[model samples]
Structures are given as C-alpha cells and as structure tokens.
Target: MSDTAATSSRRLPPANGATLGAMFVAGAVATMAFDLWGQILSPGLGWATLSPHGLARSLLGRFGLPNGDFAGYFVHFYLVGLLGYPLGWLLVFRPAWRAVIGAGGPWILPAALYGLALWVFAIGGITAIAGLPFFLDFTGITWVALIGHVLYGIVLVAVLRRFRLG
Candidate 1:
C-alpha cells in the first residue's frame, strides 16, 4: 500500500467507547459542581452571585487567592472542565490506542490530586480543616472531576504527540 493510503487507513487508539462516554459524564458532573457551588455554597458565603464565575470568584475571595475573576477552573477545577478537556481531544484529535492506554492509566489518579489541591487551597482560610467536609460533600462529583481531569491531561499529552495538534 502507498504511504497516503496507509496514513489515511490508520486505525484508532485503544481507548474504548465507554471511556469516551465516561469522559462526557465527567464533564456533565463538573458543570453540576459549578451549579451546586453557585446555588448553594456561594449564597452560604454571602457572595450572592448566581453564576459559575461568581461562585469561583467568591470562593477565591473566601480563601484569599490572587486569582479573582479567574476562569481556568472550568478546565482545572470543575468536573465539567474535566469533560471539556477530553471532549475537546476526542473530538479534535481523535485519540489512538497507544496514546489512550498509556495516558489514561495515570490520568485519573493525578487529576484527582490536582482537583483536591485546588479546592483545599481555595477554601483553606475560612473553613479550616473542619470545613473540608462541606466542600467534600460531593464525593461522586469529586471523583468524576478528578478522574476526568486525569484523563483529559493524559489525552492532551497523547493528542499533542499523536495527532500533531498545536
């Protein structure tokens, strides 16, 4: 077969359809986290802002972070942001098998760590260690975001190397 044909007929990476579906689920969960924060947590803090952005800003203020008005959390902080990353890769780069397996493995673990770190830092001041429970109330969501972020990050690495996305 010619080089053009071989390139055109190349197969996909090993990451399964379910993994992709899970990625979408993770994204949805992230969005829900933002919603819950906006509706419930922000009001409790007297932030009174009903937007996701508002919730993040209020939380930053609550913790004394310099990142007021920051929007990167949607990508790094929330499960929805988690989803956005994978969804973007799945759609844009069309990940491959080697990339999927190698990247997907560690993706879930580290992403979760990062997500928790962000949360703890965000609320470390006002809540104290005792305040962790309230923030951690969304266990299911936390898992999703963390895992999703992991997958997203790994997939991003994979995509960058595999698909040549700049």
Candidate 2:
C-alpha cells in the first residue's frame, strides 16, 4: 500500500473494550472538571456560575417534558458528557484530525480547538434552543464558559493519553 493509504488505514486505534472504557473514563472525568470550574472555582473567583442543569431544564421545558433537576443531570452527565462528547472525540474529530494532520504530532492544540468548537456549539446552538440569546450575547459568562470548555477538552485528551487511547 502507498504511504497515504497505510496512514489512512491505521489512523484510528481499534475500538474494543479497553478503548471504550478509557473513553468513558476520560469523558466522565472531563465532565467533572468542567462542572468544578463552572460550579465552584469560577464562582469562588467571582466569575459567573454555570448552571448546566438549568440549561437542560430549559431545553426540556421547551419540549414540554418534565424539566426536573434529575432530568437535567441525566442529560448533562449521562447523555452529553459520558456518551456524546467522547464519541465525538473518538469517532469524529480524531479521525478527521488524523486524516488532515497525518496523526504525528501533539494533541494539545487540536484538543483545545475542539473544546472551542464545543463552546460554540453550546453557546451558539444549545443556548438558542434553550431560549437564551445567541452566545449569551458574549457576556462574561460566555467567556467563563469558554474557559471551562477548554479545561474540559484538555482534561479529556490528557486522560485519554494516560490510557494510551489518544
């Protein structure tokens, strides 16, 4: 096979039990890190607090569903953090990144950029869906959220690397 073909074929590590477990662990830990930044650290530092539950509730309310704290937490923790974001990282972003960048360098910059993209998706898309202004009108909260998300992405990649999964 040509070098390009070989590179493409091996771009992603095989997905198996260990890999999936690592992704789950990375996702959960990263989510916890984001929650800490939003709920504790940022607030203690006089920054805006992030209420992901409220966002979840709002989205649920829009759909005329039960918008309880439990529901919100479920969406935030189980759905998005544990499943969605990790899957996006492993199955989507990593592949595209390897394809474009040839998978031979550090992942920090790409991880940060991925986090930034997620921030946009959250601020731009999720907020609008939850009936908030676009990007929260770029308020202080928006910038704080940016930092939280970047922290999340970094943590995610770091943990994955720890497992040799990245």
Candidate 3:
C-alpha cells in the first residue's frame, strides 16, 4: 500500500482517553511556542516583558494593593499566577465539543491541570533544574505571559478543528 493511503486509513480517536491526552499536549506545546516566539520578537515588537516584578506591581497597582517594593511584588505575583492559572484551562476546555476525559468537570479539570502541571514542571525542571535561564529568561513577567498562554489556547483549539486532529 502507498504511504498516502496507509496514512489516510490510520484509525483516529473516536472521542476517548488518548484524544484528550493529545489535545492537552498540543495545547501545552502551543503555549511553549508562544513564549519562545514572544521573547524572540519582544525587542523589535516593543512588547513588555513578562517579568514577575512588573506583573506583580501592575496587578497590585490596578487593585490598589500596598506593594511599593519590587521583591514583594515578585513573590505576590507568583502566587497570583498560580491561582489564576486555571483560567487558561477554563477558556480552552469549555469550547471543546468532545468529552474524551468523560463527564464535564472531570475531563476539563484534568486537561487543564495536566497542561498547567506539565508547563510549570517543564519550566522548573528543564529551565531551572537544568540551568537553562539564558533561554527561559525572556519571559520573566506576567502581562506578556498571559498574552502568550491565551494565544496558545486559542491556537490549540484552532489547530485541532482546522486539521481534524481528533
């Protein structure tokens, strides 16, 4: 059989466990790509860096929080990022038509958490543990960080339907 015919005949997920896993991985990778690309164009595009300190101060200032220091902002920003991380999941999982994870909340939460856990673990383990700051340091703030992740989620969904990934 020709390679083209064989490729076309390959069985795809009929809305089950494996498809869900694939979707989440695709989303996470999209996010990683966004980060890398954002940093690459940050200088020329005049985009703000995703620095923790800058993010903390911007958020605090918006809410009128008492944080007049950079160090304080950095710590608080990390906590804020963790808490709001699920928002990206909410955005991505809600629009999905298939229920590979089974039930509404079960699959959604796991998918979202899976993407988040993988990202944080990858960033910490690969970047920090492996001492790869020269590359990851491009995204040290939250404003641009949100842009990257939001774009990632959007691209993830778009790609799935566009290419019939499921």
RMSD of each: 11.4, 2.1, 14.7
* Predicted structure with the largest TM-score when compared to the true one: 2
Per-residue lDDT of 1-166 in model 3, one digit per residue for the tens?
9986563344333356555555555555564555554566554577765443443454455556665676444443333332233233433344332334443343334443434443564343434543345336655433355455455545554544444542
Better of 1 and 3 by TM-score: 3
Candidate 2 structure lDDT: 0.87
Q: Which lDDT value does model 2 have at 151? A: 90
For each of the candidates, give the backbone clash count.
Answer: 6, 0, 4
Taking the tens digit of each residue's C-alpha lDDT, what string does model 2 give over 103-135?
Answer: 788789889988998898888899999899999
Q: List the residue pairs that clash in candidate 2.
A: none
* Candidate 3 weakest lDDT stretch, 10 residues: 77-86
Model 1 lDDT per residue over 68-142, tens place: 555535424453355544454444334343234443454334444444444444334223432344544544444
How many clashes would you count in candidate 1? 6
- Please identify which of the two predictions, 1 or 2, would achieve the higher lDDT against the true structure: 2
lDDT of each: 0.44, 0.87, 0.46
Pairs that clash in candidate 1: 13-96, 13-97, 14-97, 30-79, 30-80, 107-150
lDDT score for residue 65 of model 3? 67
